[model samples]
Target chain A: MAQEERRILVAVDEGEESLHALSWCLENLVLQNSKDTLILLYVKPPRVVYSTFDGTGYLFSSDITAAMERYGQEVADVVLEKAKKLCNNIEKVINMVENGDPRDVICEMVQKLGADVLVMGSHGYGLIKRAFLGSVSNHCAQNAKCPVLIVKKPKPANGNQ
Target chain B: MAQEERRILVAVDEGEESLHALSWCLENLVLQNSKDTLILLYVKPPRVVYSTFDGTGYLFSSDITAAMERYGQEVADVVLEKAKKLCNNIEKVINMVENGDPRDVICEMVQKLGADVLVMGSHGYGLIKRAFLGSVSNHCAQNAKCPVLIVKKPKPANGNQ
Candidate 1:
């Protein structure tokens, strides 16, 4: 008989915060003897650079393109690194990068992978962009088929709990 | 005039799902625009339901007793129901249900109340209960604050945009 594994799909971004959220989800949802999937999501927002691609705006250029790729790779690396250290069973995890809106990708991936839940940081690299787009996290929560765990960034260390 | 306020607080309970989640928060968070205090909280596990007689348990019993008393009064229709309804602005939101555990309380409340930035839901409820006490929500997203919404229930009937 297959084990009743809880599929906790963690969504990591470009900072320590998303890792922290994934850590929480791992601890809370993925119990001992349960299967867990920690998916690292490094989403590169759609960039419309006025490049010479068909003489229209396509996201490919010298610095902007390189910088975007660099940032995307960095995000994936950092998030996965921190997450690996934070997770319990490393064998049940996977990490990768995607290009598009975080919310849409998150929802799509959740459906595609049959993710039971989504774990994410509340505030991430694209706060301004999210606000402009009416909140990426909000869109994900409203649209995603699975449950989402929203983690708040910890305050600068002080007496705050 | 109201400082362009934007926040939504939701009290979550896992069993409820949907309208009890982000939808509830979104519905009520937008209730007062800038003045809204979006608080998404899952009340911690109710301290062991000690009877109303001994020690620290007395304090909690008093609160429950008060709630029960009010419930009774409303049932009898002796007191003006509208008075209680009109006096508390917090009670106006839909899809919020009070649960025995603090975790459920915070999440459902926040979802129903619709706060802008969630004040406390994950750690406060989970950490407070501890492993022995069995607080589940504690393991949720730990960095979700602003634009962070909660959902104790499932999605609404009309579907989210």
Candidate 2:
């Protein structure tokens, strides 16, 4: 039987965890399949709307906001560049950058692009911290339309191992 | 760099959803790798303790209890048999049957066997239903040491598609 080409969407970020996931996917899933498309997605945080006055009663300047946006773009570029190097052997690679919350953007893109699988990296945050700050991977796993693969970074080798 | 042989543990059950996940794994992950080990795990519900006298004032016979155990084994056999057929092309396949809660069992096995990837099927229950009856896949995805892949069965294609 002929195999259908698959679109594997991988969410990348500035963190090492996401980069690790991309490498793992490339090694395990992408290296063997020349037909599959590897989509590297980086979601920038939504642009902040600034009022005239800041919380500290300081004047909010447009320059500050613009600088922040530029920084976000640079970070996205660095992440996508690192991910691309890992996919050097892959034939079809698509780089995408969307500005929004990572969780929502990932879920939406998976459905819109008809992705066969969504690969993400676990932050490995503690329970308390995860509750205070929402986990993007966990949220995407619950809400995404396609299969979700959460790749965990293995712990450093202990003497026992 | 040569890739390391990976142990892929797939959690199977009597439900069609799990069988579908096994099929997906075979097509996507197992076919290309001859050295990778495919572990097919089927977790049976823990045996119930039967009292001599029932709450309804009926006596529970040993025969009835034995028959229930037999039925459970039969179901596990049927599921394993069907899964085996799907895995006929694969060279290394290991069948495992354990009795316990599936969520706990799967998480424990992944760690004990040092599985590289754990594949499971999403029941795809709605939010409310998922809340009432806890989702096994969700629990394992959060707790398992290895990467967890939750394969969701694709919805029936509509005429427009």
Candidate 3:
């Protein structure tokens, strides 16, 4: 029987770990002459909600918020551009940008896009930091409907554990 | 450049979830005419240490311990047999049985065997049970040297969350 085409969704970010994961997926998962759809998803953080008064009791201006949103878009564009270069040989590649908490957005997109597999990068955070700031890969692995592959960037041989 | 062959390690057990994961890997990850190696690993729980005196002060015999050990081995054989049947089309396949805490044994074997990717099933335990019992897949994903793929069995259409 002929194999069905798969939709592989890869979560990309500004971090080197994410880019490394993208390269690994391209090398290992994407097969030659296969009609697989590679979806590159970059999620921007949700817009910061600011009250009229700042924490220091100073009035918050709309211009600062607009600038921040613009910066977020620019960062997304840069990351997507870098990711696109790595997929030049792929026949079908899609780039997407969404705004929300990455942990939630990634799982939602995987279902929304009917992804066959979800590839992500592990931040390799220590216990303390992971407890304080939750790990996105961990959350998605537990929540995503499809198979989730968490790619860890190998540590330096000379580095400490 | 020619793509390098990869060693893919899969963890299996008596659970239906694991068998489903094996089928998923065979369908999605394993390629035809590729020289990839598929390692099927089944981890038997460590032997239960029995004291001379039982909980009710009854004398415990060596025969009981021996029977338990035999049962563990039999279960491993059964699971490996079932998993092997799914990989009949694959060119290279290896079956392994180890006795220890699965979370530790799996991570150690992934490094020891030089596996490129580790595939396992997600039990999908609830927050309360997962917190108390700990998740082997979660631990391996966090600690393993190579990438970890946690394949979640899709719930029934009418199943509760």
Q: Please name the candidate that would achieve the greatest TM-score relative to the true structure.
A: 3
Which docking class does model 2 fall in?
acceptable
Model 2 over residues A32-64: C-alpha lDDT tens digits?
545788999988766532221245756547798
What tens digits encode model 1's per-residue C-alpha lDDT throughout B80-144? Answer: 23222322454333322243555444444444444434522222332223444443343223222
**Candidate 1 TM-score, C-alpha based:** 0.50
> Fnat of each prediction?
0.19, 0.46, 0.52
Query: DockQ, in order, for the candidates?
Result: 0.10, 0.44, 0.48
| Model 1 residue B44 distance off true place after TM-score fit, in angstroms | 19
**Which ranges of candidate 2 are over 4 A from the true structure?**
A1-3, A48-61, A124-133, A158-161, B1-3, B48-64, B124-133, B158-161
Residue-by-residue lDDT tens digits, candidate 1, A30-59: 544445455666666555411332354454
Q: Comparing 2 and 3 by lDDT, which wins?
A: 3
Candidate 2 accuracy as lDDT: 0.76
Better of 1 and 2 by lDDT: 2
Interface RMSD list for the candidates: 14.7, 2.9, 2.8
